[model samples]
Target: MMTVNEVSKLTGVSIRALQYYDKIGLLHPAEYTEAGYRLYDDTALERLQQILLFRELEFSLKEIQSILQSPDFDRDRALDQQICLLTLKKEHIENLITFARGLKQVGGMNMDFSAFDTAKMDEYATKAKEKWQHTNAYQEYTQKNKGRSKDAEEALARGVMLIFSDFGKCKDGDPALPEAQALVKRLQAYISENYYQCTPEILQTLGAMYGAGGEFTENIDKAGGEGTAKFVERAISIYCK
Candidate 1:
């Protein structure tokens, strides 16, 4: 068994946070020593690891507590989902960075599409196609992106993120405006071009996910500035409707 101070140092979670978790019954130590110290066994340490994972995914402590206490909680399934979501986050961050770099190269008013080439993108899309080939939701994407060129794929990612930045500039604009609708159309077409054929149903789901407070949401927010994710969701809602 390890003491609370030891667990704090090992896990980088503050002793105060751990104490509060114990107080709220979120995490309980394995035993109490004669000196009134908290002693956590290996099982407790493992549980704490799971809690940190959920926290990293932006789950509120209450939500995490409920999830852990639920009879249906599956650690493996949860970890898998988190892994997929975080991977998407990393991809979005990279795409957003590429978008920003493009702006620096071509000036903010006009984007030089050539800055993002096709070869790298095509390869990435090919990899995505392979990854999702067995999934029915991405059949169209898989088939369309097969043997596609790298330049086309790269431009699609850059173009989409740039549009997101434009959307940030339109925070006050109506989602139903002609320009906004047009942008959403570009978004749909871009996805269909570079990744999958994003049907209205899929686009709507993506809009919601962009506002869902994970990496996807953060990516859009970063590209479009504050409130961009929700704006995109609202715009997509109208566009898809």
Candidate 2:
């Protein structure tokens, strides 16, 4: 048996979090010394390892507790399921990267169905539940573009990204310049043509989101360079003003 401090050092689980786990009945000391110090056995350490694994996957503490305490909990089976889910997520990310590269190569002029179909893009979007897909812009886009052919959608996507690519090259330029504002205009028009009726208000919101980071920031920065996202935001400000 090991004391709480010893367990903390061995497992790297903070003493405070361990104490909270013990208080919440999620993990209790296996024994107690005469002086009332908590003592954990090897079995307890093993359980703590499992808890950490679940936490890494973003499961809530309460959910992790409940699942571990479930009558039918099967550790081996749970590990198998986690492996499968992680593998699927990996595949989804890899496919998106490949599709993005292909789009960049298309130059926004012609549709490329060499490796991916339009339906496939839609299918992946649904499965990934990307951040943009949750936005009003996406909703408006889908609604406006409804009933459009897959080929049309692919062409529109390439056109939109081409504008973004231009923005990527002007990270240090003034957003108020004709070139920057012109690209912003093209971006708005392209959206209106394909996805939704992008008013000035909608375009402004998109500008904020682009610089706000995550996939949008990453994509924009990839097209232009480091500050390209902020450049787009500034240009949108000028255009929408």
Candidate 3:
């Protein structure tokens, strides 16, 4: 585990920015020390890498948060897109550099402006953004959350955490038990009612995320207990089956 200061030094992200990210639910540390200092594990660092890559693509903090939190977010697919975008950006820069050097050599205005054309890169970025943001579930979430007050959104988020806290109460019980399964159903219903439809497939994905040892797992465990997130994941798996 690394302290927040360590992470800041390693990633060159300001400590204040990291704190803001935590406040806004962008990227949470893996755990906190008893002294209230933030600590991060490898999983958190990996997430930071993703965040940086998205930032390189000029995604807004809100957009990055949404994409990272999406149920359909695929890290590998995101990497692929990031790679393509970076490659295009690199080529564009190289072309511009060559064009500038040619202009300097001629010491006169060049009519050729093709080096500045970014239509292809811009088109790819637009398509990639659409792929990441225009999912039916995302559209539905946007529609449902339209005009929602900040307090209302916080209340809804608290409601979900409360369900996880309830899961903590039964962490020692069998996940296949009716009690655990019922909670899983309740969670699915709550998400579907307030956000997007929680199909079994999506729930399964969320379950995996809950236990995947990153911010989601950290938040769930914080709401519940140390093992509550893993227990909830198991319960959801059984419920989905």
Clashes of each: 6, 2, 0
State every prediction's TM-score relative to the real structure: 0.44, 0.42, 0.85
Q: Rank the candidates by lDDT, best first.
A: 3, 1, 2
Question: After superposing candidate 3, which stretches have Cα over 4 Å from the reference?
Answer: 1-9, 14-23, 28-45
Instruction: Give me candidate 1's TM-score against the actual structure.
Output: 0.44
Residue-by-residue lDDT tens digits, candidate 1, 1-241 = 8999999999999999999998766788877999989999776887788788777665677656655543234578667756765676676667778888777898757545544454444454445324423444445554554564546645655787898998888867898998888889988887766665577877887887677664456667778887998889899999988
Candidate 1, residue 93: Cα displacement in angstroms equals: 39
RMSD each, Å: 23.3, 24.9, 2.7
Q: In lDDT terms, how accurate is model 3? A: 0.89
* Candidate scoring better on TM-score of 1 and 3: 3
- Mind giving the per-residue lDDT tens digits that candidate 3 earns over 194-229? 989999999999999999876788889889999999
Question: Model 1, stretches more than 4 Å misplaced?
Answer: 1-133, 143-155
True-vs-predicted CA distance for residue 148, candidate 3, Å: 3.3
- Judged by TM-score, which candidate is best? 3
Across 132-191, the per-residue lDDT of candidate 2 in tens digits comes to: 244565556546655756466557656766888898776577888888888998898877
